[model samples]
Target: MPDAGTLQLSGAGTTKTLPCHAGYLSVSGKNNTITLTGHCTSVTVSGNDNRVAVDSTDALSASGAGNVVVYHWGSPKIVSAGTANVVRQG
Candidate 1:
């Protein structure tokens, strides 16, 4: 298991810089794939940024200079910062 849900992501963004955060990461299962519906701040994703996993019971939360939103089943969950990971396969 992961020591914590949100792991720090080193490099990402338009400048291609790394912000030590765990934001805007996507996770999938064997049966289903979950796409991030939206977010609070500017998010960047690459192979390195997407380096973690999560459970259905768990979720990724994030907030920056702008805002953060976590959506599950069309509902919203809030957090200052968070991580999302693939749990199982369908």
Candidate 2:
């Protein structure tokens, strides 16, 4: 289930960097390289070749090709559904 007031990322942008003050975030666009600071309860990525960086995540799901998600802090529950997708925790 997604949050009612979640932050959504779509369309094309030039490497957006943001802070997560919300509980959930959804990414659904192409060629979006996003860096996120702070903590998010959940994150969903459904776009191709999107790069995502986060401070922490409680839950995460990715369904795309060549997408990369990096996390630091907390144990995140992750699910990936594509080729060449990377998830790193540190």
Candidate 3:
């Protein structure tokens, strides 16, 4: 189950920009590019070759292969698993 303020995106070869509103974001699938504006409480990404950029977040988790997550601000608690997953502050 997902939280009430959770935003989810799942697909392949897609691009989107959304507002976080200090809530949670979940992303899955392959070759997708996502940009999140506003403040995020938490962000989770799972899949292959996905790229996610966030303005700010308190927590960030990236899993699966070739996933990349970049946060512009905030000292987020970061977690990276699987092969070639990258989570970092930018």
lDDT by residue (1-90, candidate 1, tens digit) is 122223223333312122223344432212221233222122222232332222222344432222222233322233343343222221
What global local distance difference test value does model 3 have?
Answer: 0.90
Which residue pairs in model 3 clash with each other? Answer: none
lDDT for each of the candidates? 0.28, 0.83, 0.90
Q: Which candidate should be chosen as best, given TM-score against the real structure?
A: 3
Better of 2 and 3 by TM-score: 3
Query: Per-residue lDDT tens digits of candidate 2, residues 9-78?
Result: 8886548877786468899877898888888888898878888889998888998788888998888999
Q: Which ranges of candidate 1 are over 4 A from the true structure?
A: 1-7, 14-57, 67-77, 80-90
Error of model 3, residue 1, in angstroms: 17
Clashing pairs in 2: none
- 17 Cα displacement, candidate 2 (Å): 1.5
Best by lDDT: 3
In terms of TM-score, which candidate is stronger, 1 or 3? 3
Q: What's the ranking of the predictions by TM-score, best on top?
A: 3, 2, 1
lDDT of 1 at 84: 39
Off by over 4 Å in 3: 1-4
